[model samples]
Target chain A: MTERAIPWPMMALAVVGFAYMLLPIFVVVLAGLTAGEFLTFPPEGLSLRWVAAFLQSEKYLSAFFFSFRLALMTMVVATILGTAAALFLARSNVVGKAALRAFFLSPVVLPGVVVGFALFAFFIYSGMGLSRTIWGLWIGHILYSTPYVIGTVGAALAAYDDSLEEAARSLGASPWRAFRKVTLPNISQGIQAGSIFAFIVSFGQFEVSLFLSAPNAEPLPIAMYNSLRYQFDPSAAAAGIFAITLVIASVLLTNRLVNIRRLLGRQQGQ
Target chain B: MTEATAARATGARLAAPALSRARLTWLLVVPLLVFLTVFFVIPVGLLFATSLNPQTIGQVTVTSDLTLDNYLRFFSRSNYLLATGRSVALGAIVAAVTLVVAYPMAFVIAKTAHPGRNTALLILVLAAMQLDMVIRLYGMMVILGDEGLVNQMLRGIGLIGAESSVQLMYNFLGVVLGLVQFALPFMILTLVGVIRGIDPSLEEAARSLGASRRRAFFRVTLPMSLPGILSGSLLVFALSISSYIVPALMGGFRVGVLPIHIFQQVAEGARFQFGATIAVILFLLSAGAVAIYLRVGARASGGRA
Candidate 1:
């Protein structure tokens, strides 16, 4: 700990700031658990009725599971591609390296809505038969999710010790084997954290799915959006409860697998 | 061996391996490069082309009769022009407010040297960021709605009549508040790094030299952390302007920002050319902000950032 006292006024300001950040979240969770018919805060009384309703509702349940499947698919592909790109970036002395890195991460810098619309329009023109299909949505998701994997894994690669892999190579192990043995183990935690993040991001992705989602099979966020628009129901809050649960679970899981602080400390800050 | 002979020999050996390594690494990145080009760049490029086309519904590709009708329409229409302005205004407001709300939090987090307390603080920030925007904003609905928590509290405290309820959500103010809430974590995280990187002794030196604590912070530490403040606000600006969900939900479709306009035109109205027009404008705006961010970031880092 530092020797400084961190003035009380600053601490008080911080507490208020934190309360502002947390107020909405606290309200949502409590409202979801409320026994009342409509969403309300300071719960009229606590129960699992909304959760049960969410689980049983065909429309919400299907969308939730569909989102789960989509996230799974997005995570797998983004991990492989993003990890490969990050590794290449770290190891290669390619020309215009900075430009290339910028290009790879550019999809995320644009609004997700733009990316979704562009892809939706592209699919319509290309005659690829992917428009409004799950394939188009998946592609959009991959574009959105891969940069995060790159960010996290790139942080891991930056922190990794290179000499250990060099030592393995010097001991006559094959280059691939040396990488698998020394380097993979070291950065595997990063890959795991990144992939999990990809899952979380894709699962919660709302903007991109807004344009690309299939009419018949709306993703969870879009479903909730529609529900919230047309009807005010606690089940939407219940849906939020699950989304928040996934977010919390992913954070805890990532913290366990890697020093999340180090990842944030890096410039990538995915 | 003599120095000259050894140098020549090593150069020959190193050159071969160096060339091969570059080739190998380029090969490794090719797949991802191809994937993004196919799926990302081309699509956006097509959208730009579509925006240039004449007002033709269901036309997703460029045509020979390319005209700037969509652009002209956007420029000519008061609502669209006003939306463009509103989008910029909202982004700037959100960025400024986020800076104010987040700076103290970042300061506290950065100065808290205790590992457990710091970790807890960091976790709260990260968790809030990771929580789904839709889910988190649902909480906003609960808090900021007419009958929401804030209004209910005000009524309980007799600040207003029992019959009155202030309209917070479904308006510009709600969008600004939601954007600020969404942006706080990012601004805090960015500033925390810079603030922590600042040397404590600099402030101590000011204090030792007879400056008040506040004076030292304002004169020394605050100036030093300007890079973070600038970049974080720029980041927040990009996020807020480009955001679709926050404005859509919190504004309840009543706030016609650029993003909301794009969604209404393209997704709901099927006006692809018009949507693409608004999108291109939005893209240029965000791109301008990002370009500034890159410049400021480079200067801040004293190199690549």
Candidate 2:
């Protein structure tokens, strides 16, 4: 506590940064309540028409369901694959471990666009672009989101003590039984954190789906992007508000359940 | 630290008997290894092959010959090279700016008194991950565009006449602002993780050495945080370079980045070979930058610890 004046410059910088971060969110929330036809700021007036419109539209409703189901499926698959990889890497004295870890984590470093391109080419080459089905979108989402899963689970397992599993084994448990009864519970927080991340990443994906989405199947972000690009409708803003609400709720719920603050704190590098 | 981590790791293996260990390890890693090889490694190799041989670019029989013309064209054209340079320059500047802005913010969050700091970080992190890129870009347009909020506010304030042509959106500044806004959270989050891991005693010792607050912070805190700063900056730069939507939406059609060009080449212009080559270049650049970042982090951590 030096009796110095407040660092006004630094404080101003902080204000600007926070404002920049929050401005879009504020705009979307505000515009969602707009009475106007277009997404004008200082919105013309307050109304719930667009929200009602969004809910009433069948296309939006189906796409929303499709996205939700896909995200959930991606979350489960990614969590399983990622947790398995994390467990293997954490316990294995395997040769070429560093290279293997890098390969597994490469999705994190690769640009989403490049991954989207590669997947597009590979799918086309393999004649897997038959129907642009929900399955294709799910596969792409899993590819993109699995890295975060592996990272979070790996971090959690690193903090985990082996003694617990050993204790289980010494108490007349089989190796599989010990791992099932001991290791899984200890790393549940990681799985929870990874699942949330996998969900959010899969849900928010645009780049991969941009190449992969069919005319019939589109993620919400792609839908929003197309809507905005094609028209200046307030529905985009309404969609944004909905997405933000989901994100905030998901994050808060995960934090409440798993102490995600600590998970994020440990997931710096991963 | 690595030795201790390794020793503890060895204890896990010793938990299982030697007879079943080999089989277990093999089984454990098999799925992961196969998944990576099939989906990731092979695809990247195929991409490289397509880029090398134009015959595979979407079944078009342009040529059966192997050529470096795609790479040469990107380099030989002044506009292409200029866009690449601009992308790098913009990336570097945004990363530097984000770092400078985030350091104080991270320091405040990491060192501040309890509840306020925690709330601030939670909000920042959550807001940062809110993936509404189009709306975010729209908000930016409003703030910076001609008929946007800032201009409206400025005109109301009588800061300048109503006839002023102070264009802000669809330019370098707009693009940079959006890039910085989007990438700043990543840097802050990365730094927060690293900074929180540093022992507070190091700063306390410097403070007790009869040093001024500024001097202590510069000598102790900043040096300790270098690894975080380096890694965060690299990550930010890599993200900025590869970003397509932000630059495309905000930069009008005047300013072209590598990604924007690649998008046009692939989707609009139908130049698959050139587009694949550009994607490869982008991939290489990001990987190279990450490699350099990890090496720097290793050296700095080794030096300090």
Q: Global lDDT of each model?
A: 0.86, 0.75
Q: Can you tell me which runs of candidate 2 are displaced by over 4 Å?
A: A1-9, A39-41, A58-60, A130-132, B1-16, B55-64, B115-120, B160-165, B300-305
Q: In candidate 1, which residue ranges exceed 4 Å CA deviation?
A: A1-3, A39-42, A268-270, B2-15, B303-305
Lowest lDDT 10-residue stretch of candidate 2 chain B:
B55-64
Tell me the deviation in Å of residue A257 in model 2.
Answer: 3.0
What would the per-residue lDDT of candidate 2 be over residues B85-118, giving only the tens digit for each residue?
A: 9989988999998888777776656655465567
Chain A TM value for model 1: 0.94
Query: In terms of TM-score, which candidate is strongest?
Result: 1
Candidate 1 per-residue C-alpha lDDT over A83-196 given as tens digits, one digit per residue, 9 for 90 to 100: 999999888766887678877887776788988989888887889988877778888899989988988999999999777876786576766788898999999999999999
Chain A vs native chain A, TM-score per candidate: 0.94, 0.91
Local error of candidate 2 at residue A163 (angstroms): 1.8
